[model samples]
Target chain A: MTSCSGTVLLSRITAGIPHSAAYDDLPYTRGGAVDRDAVGALVQSAADGDAAAWKALVDGLSPLVWSVVRAHRLSDADAHEVYQTAWFRFAQHLDRIREPHKAGSWLASTARHECLKVIKSTRRLTPTDDPQVLDGISEDRTPEESLIESEEAAAEAERIRRMWQEFEELGDRCRELLRVLMASPPPSYQEVSGALGIAVGSIGPLRQRCLRRLRARLVARGVR
Target chain B: MNDNVGNDSFDEAAQDDALEEALRRAAAILDPVPAELRHLAVEAYALHSLRDLDARLAELTFDSLVDALPVRGADVPRMLTFSTGDLTVDIEVTAEGLTGQVLPPQPARIEILGTAQPTATGTVTADEMGRFLCDLLLTGPFALRLRTDEEVVVTEWLRV
Candidate 1:
């Protein structure tokens, strides 16, 4: 909770000047694997009128993009709408981006912000439902409650139902930790630690413990 | 216990190092990305293809998501309006598909494109007043390109 509010300091090493250069600097990939320069250059290429570069950016960042929006568990229609608009906003403001190379985080933030709009509008449409849907998200409710709510609270019991229920039984902290872990393409431990407000050094050690605890809960309940 | 955990290596170097692969896989099953998500993300990039350096939509004056006149009844068609450098196009969208007209009207060739394929996948001609309609069932992202003896005008790609 404390960690997510931390400034998402993107690698703004590139000059903030828009359209000043092609994506020549290296851009890094998910899992911290090196492609730093390639991604940087790709963004530049996209900015400088390279359609292929733009395509490459989407191809590479699709997992992150999908992950960020999918994390919200919007109805399929709303999810797609948010997805298209995220890219559309990028397309419209391509020139204004301060650091085009850090588009992964930028797009992630955009999709996350867009989720708020959709969730709010959805509330407006359904007056009889819980208005606390997502408004309480940035505030009080635990990640476990939100995850259940996000995935459609009234979903009838099924296989995944057991899994989610078992997941919820892992307690608040583990549920929050793993929720961040399951993010598409998965965020780095440092990013995860920062977002979740856990100590950076303990994230790796804690990840194993959390998953192991969840496994134990599942096994104890006779869940495969 | 696996010897890996006993090591004091809290650093990510030997940390996640694929240790959580199973959890990652299980989580995927719990919440899978729609198969079409990636394709549509890619198709969204086709809008960038319209970035031919200078040519661009002058302004997207109106869109249903924004300043659309609200419909009080059911089966209302969604609407949008865009102004390029020279011409302005007004469009109405519905479950049946898209129909539109260009301002300062004149005869022109209209191409309805499926973003899953190439641009202008299917072509139609507008009547003398620059009004054109298409019955193409849109299942994916798309763009519209209008051509005449004067020049070619293309709208940014969109999902209808």
Candidate 2:
């Protein structure tokens, strides 16, 4: 798989040395960028055994995966399991990815599939897509909130905690949509649609509605 | 009137954008991807090396948990099937361990792949009947790598 050449190329790229005049064409050069073309290039390089390219790919797309898993409201352990499984499968199939440019969409779909499997395996009822039905489900504090306590300032942390309390009041569907939309570097609507199994055209309107609902809740509590 | 209406909608969108931006920032701090998970994902890249280039991936065709209806009040075992056109592996995962058969009934060596461990957590060999049993119950993400006389086949990764 040209492992030697890939290593040489990656080392040169990583060392800030131009391997060729087409240095811009090197995938690792665009480290942490999450565009379709950049993703495709990283996938190719990773498949060729470039570790840097693989790390870049994971760094860029892990948030999308995390967001998708959290959207299913799985327990932290289950979510971690699903996250690992999705990335593991993706790693196994890295060479065979038909559309490397759509890696974000692929990871999102895989995460969603794994989440459903966990839900079904645990005998939990499948979450309804209807936002109204989702409104009835109550949420418990996630482990992340507790983790945030040590890292944030006192008043700021309190405000964030209050904001999250309101955020939890959102319906499942709204929460899911917003969660995916909130991914770091932000995912494109195409990726969000793929992640949520919603129409691309509907994302804007849905996101608008979800945000409005979250804002109203936050405002009522004087936390916004 | 149309201009005013358009401006109103734009303003609403802008407001939504502002609120979403704030929430996104907060969610980043509140629910950032755990560092360990990202590290694990990066480590997964090592799973497929040049030596595994020829190994056929057995795609997961069926999983009882995802495809079959639940039988109430029963401790139903999770069933999984993976295939690669010519080869098939069917597994039943119970509380105690895993039992599975490599179809076409030929002896083979199987390595249980677990994400937690850098290497295969365990190895078991199938008998002439292509059936094998492992008494060690598995947890977390796992897969099976089968090494037959002719070729190597790896199953889809799953959380057991």
**TM, every model:** 0.53, 0.83
lDDT of each: 0.56, 0.77
Clashes of each: 11, 0
How large a fraction of the reference contact set does each model reproduce?
0.22, 0.66
Clashing pairs in 2: none
Cα lDDT for residue B49, candidate 2: 62
Give the lDDT of residue A8 in candidate 1.
Answer: 18
In candidate 2 the C-alpha lDDT for residue B26 amounts to 58
User: Which stretches of model 2 miss by more than 4 angstroms?
Assistant: A1-33, A124-153, B1-5
DockQ (model 1, Cα): 0.11
lDDT of 1 by residue, A79-139 (tens): 6766776676576556657876566656766676566555543443322222232232223
Task: Give the runs in model 1 whose Cα sits over 4 Å from its true position.
Answer: A1-30, A33-38, A46-56, A74-99, A105-182, A185-224, B1-55, B69-72
RMSD, candidate 1, Å: 13.7
DockQ of all candidates, in order? Answer: 0.11, 0.41
